[model samples]
Structure formats: structure tokens, C-alpha cells
Target: MLASLITFFLIGLVALVVLGVVLAIVGAVFSAVLGLAGFVLFKVVPVVLLGYVIVRFLAPKEKRLAQMERKLLETD
Candidate 1:
């Protein structure tokens, strides 16, 4: 009976250890995913938006300049 009790205790301890390891792994994965999401939100997204704004700001001026050049050439 004592042996059986000891065996049950060891099994419980092992189960607890396994559960702790699983939780640690899950926590690490969650942390890594959050870090990546934060990097994209803070770093990548702003750069892309800035590039988009710069392009939008320049495009209309470029089209106007192109139209003026065409008119000048046609007059010649």
C-alpha cells in the first residue's frame, strides 16, 4: 500500500512537471507572436504609409509637368 501511494505521488509530480513545461512553451510562442505583431505595427506599417503618402504627393505634380511638356512640344 505504501509503494502504491509512492507510485501515485510520483505520477502526479510528473504530470505537474509536464503541465508546467507545456505552459512555458505556450507562453514563449505567444510572446514571440506578439513581438512580431508589434514590429509590423510600429515599424513596417509606418514606413509603408509614409511611402504611400510621398507617392501620392508627387504623382499629381508629375502629371501636370508632363502635360505642360506635351503642350510645349505640340506648340513647337
Candidate 2:
């Protein structure tokens, strides 16, 4: 009976270790996904948006003049 109990205990310990390894793997995958999302949200999106704004600002003078005139008319 004592030998059977020890066998059962070792089996249980092995099961727990397997569960822990699976959880760690899943957590690492989620961490990688979140890291990529954060990089796009915090870094890539802002750079793209800033570049868009800069392009608009550097557009043709005639287009800017039209926008300025429109703004003036809207304020009146």
C-alpha cells in the first residue's frame, strides 16, 4: 500500500509539472502578441500619422491657399 501511494504521488507531481509548462507556453504566446500590438499602436501608427500630417503641410501652395480661404469663410 505504501509503494502504491508513492507511485500515485509521483504521477500527480508529473501532471502538475506538465500543466505548468503548458500554461507558461500559452503565456509566452500572449506576451508576444501583446508586444507586437503595442509596438504598432505606440510606434508605427504615430509615425504614419505624423508622416501624413507632414505631407499635407507640404502640399501645393494653391491647395493650402484654398484651405485657408475656406477656413476664413467658415469663421465669418
Candidate 3:
């Protein structure tokens, strides 16, 4: 019974060590991915803002066209 208990403790210790190592590696990978995602989000935000500005600039002309089309449809 004593030898069996010793064996069980040793096996559990080894398993815990291996699990710790695997978790450390996974943590590093997730940290890097989070950093990359942050960079991409920063980059995309400005482009999106610029796109909105351009659309806003063109909106007046689009509104004029839409109104003309609607008027013609009503006549038909």
C-alpha cells in the first residue's frame, strides 16, 4: 500500500508539470494573437473613418439623384 501511494504521487507530480508547460505555451500564443488583433483594429479604424468622410461628401449628389428618380416613378 505504501509503494502504491508513492507511485501515485510521483505520477501526479509529473502530470502537473507537463500540464503547466502546455498552459504556458498556450498563454504566450494567445498574448501574441491579442497584440496582432489590436494592431489590426487600430489600422482599420482610420480607414473606416476616412471612408465615412468620403461617403458623407458624396451624399448630397446621391440624394439629388434619388429624388429625381422618385419623381419620375410617381409620374409612371
- Candidate maximizing lDDT: 2
Reference-based TM-score, model 1: 0.75
The sequence of per-residue lDDT tens digits that candidate 3 reaches over residues 1-76 is 9999999999999999999999999999999999999988899888998999998777798797898899999999
TM-score, predicted candidate 2 vs. hidden true structure: 0.63
Ranked candidates, highest lDDT first = 2, 1, 3
lDDT of each: 0.96, 0.98, 0.93
Q: What digit string (tens of lDDT, one per residue) describes model 2 on residues 1-76? A: 9999999999999999999999999999999999999999999999999999999889999999999999999999
TM-score of each: 0.75, 0.63, 0.56
**Model 1 agreement with the true structure over 28-70: per-residue lDDT tens digits:** 9999999999999999999999999998777888797898899
Q: How accurate is candidate 1 locally (lDDT)?
A: 0.96
Question: Which whole-number lDDT from 0 to 100 does residue 21 have in model 3?
Answer: 100
* Alpha-carbon RMSD to native, per candidate: 6.8, 4.0, 4.0
Model 2 / residue 12 / CA error / Å: 0.6
Please give the distance, in angstroms, between residue 70's alpha carbon in candidate 1 and its true position after superposition. Answer: 19
Count of backbone collisions in candidate 1: 0
